[model samples]
Target: MTTQHLQNRVDPWGQLRTVASRGTRMGNRGILHNDANQVVRPWKHKRWVTCMLEFKQIKRPKPFSRGNYSELFFLDEATAFAAGHRPCGDCQKARHLDFKEKWLAANVDAQLRSAISMDDVDKVLHAERCVPGGGKTTFAATLGELPKGTMFEFAEAAFLVSAAGYLPWSFDGYGPAKRIDGATAVTVLTPASIVRAFEQGFVALVHASAGLDDPAAVASAQKNPS
Candidate 1:
């Protein structure tokens, strides 16, 4: 029998899967060691973080080795943000700074803007990512009101709302764009604060299927201006 590895792909909802694509980076909560290389615990702490694949010439750890954190992968930063993770300060300093700057500037309230720390942001994200029972926390919004890179649920499926259009999200990749001009209120899966960051012009890198390069699609998106 093949031994399952603890390394797995993480979706926007924080669910783990044994998909083929591991993306470009590795993420972790904390050390999750066991005999079977399975994620025995949901997470070790609230400080979930994403790190660069190569950092300070550090060597890759043995996959699912004893006394190491469970490895998680994401398609990109957008996917990581959607999954309620922040950039690692050590390995991803530039991204961490950028994220912090935007996160601070997006908060209009003086007290919140000035007093927040990475831990505080993680706390808020933790609450937004999971519910009391065991699912993601979601809110309702119209398609036009949501910014690009926001993920939402409609008709029992998840979609990534980009400038071009809504792209269906799956474990493999994003599907073709679907126009949502007639869409009413839908359940937004991305956390409210992160959505506000996108609204403030902090762009997240989306998958190629977002159709960001097509001129006609860009024009259509500009006309709609979501």
Candidate 2:
């Protein structure tokens, strides 16, 4: 028997797919699926976030139930961040708070406020990642200038800047690393504000396939600081 999958897997560009892999993180944007278990809309609210796949060992038999928020999966936190999602304040409270603090510190001039709320971050992120009517928003930046863990589009494909190289991204996992040039300008898929947060020392968790755990890759990366 073949198991059918739902169209709920989100990519770095925030587009939904029916991939077999469930990914490391899950999140929602309110009730976007209909009673028929079909995604009828892109999003239902501005508060888009990414959370742990298993929170408090909670179990839900019907993930796409009509009234409940649609369950969305991302390959990893890096992918989620690139897709304009922040950590969930419920399932991933500590992560969310850390992200918020770093994000607020990095975007001080963006909001012009003494105290920043998650809603404020959501508003800024929504504007940076989404178009008014439709489509994902992107900005241009030098590939090497972007911090490690940032995702960018290069040669019509998505790649994560791992160490000193770029790892090709896919729903299943990342591919081999490719050398990166500091002078190469590219369109970054991640939101500008999130990139700023990453620059401010906010480290995002990536899959092991990113070669972050490999000692040789680390040494190579250290030797070639791109």
Task: Compare the candidates by TM-score and give the number of the best one.
Answer: 2
For model 2, residues 61-180, the per-residue Cα lDDT tens digits are 566875778988877888998888899999878988889888888888655655767887899999999886548999999887999889999998999987737899998778998786
Q: RMSD of each candidate?
A: 7.3, 6.8
Off by over 4 Å in 1: 1-7, 211-226
lDDT of 2: 0.82
TM-score attained by model 1: 0.84
Compared with the true structure, model 2 gives a TM-score of: 0.90
- Total clashing residue pairs per candidate? 0, 0
Q: Please give the distance, in angstroms, between residue 29's alpha carbon in candidate 2 and its true position after superposition.
A: 0.8
What TM-score would each prediction reach against the true structure?
0.84, 0.90
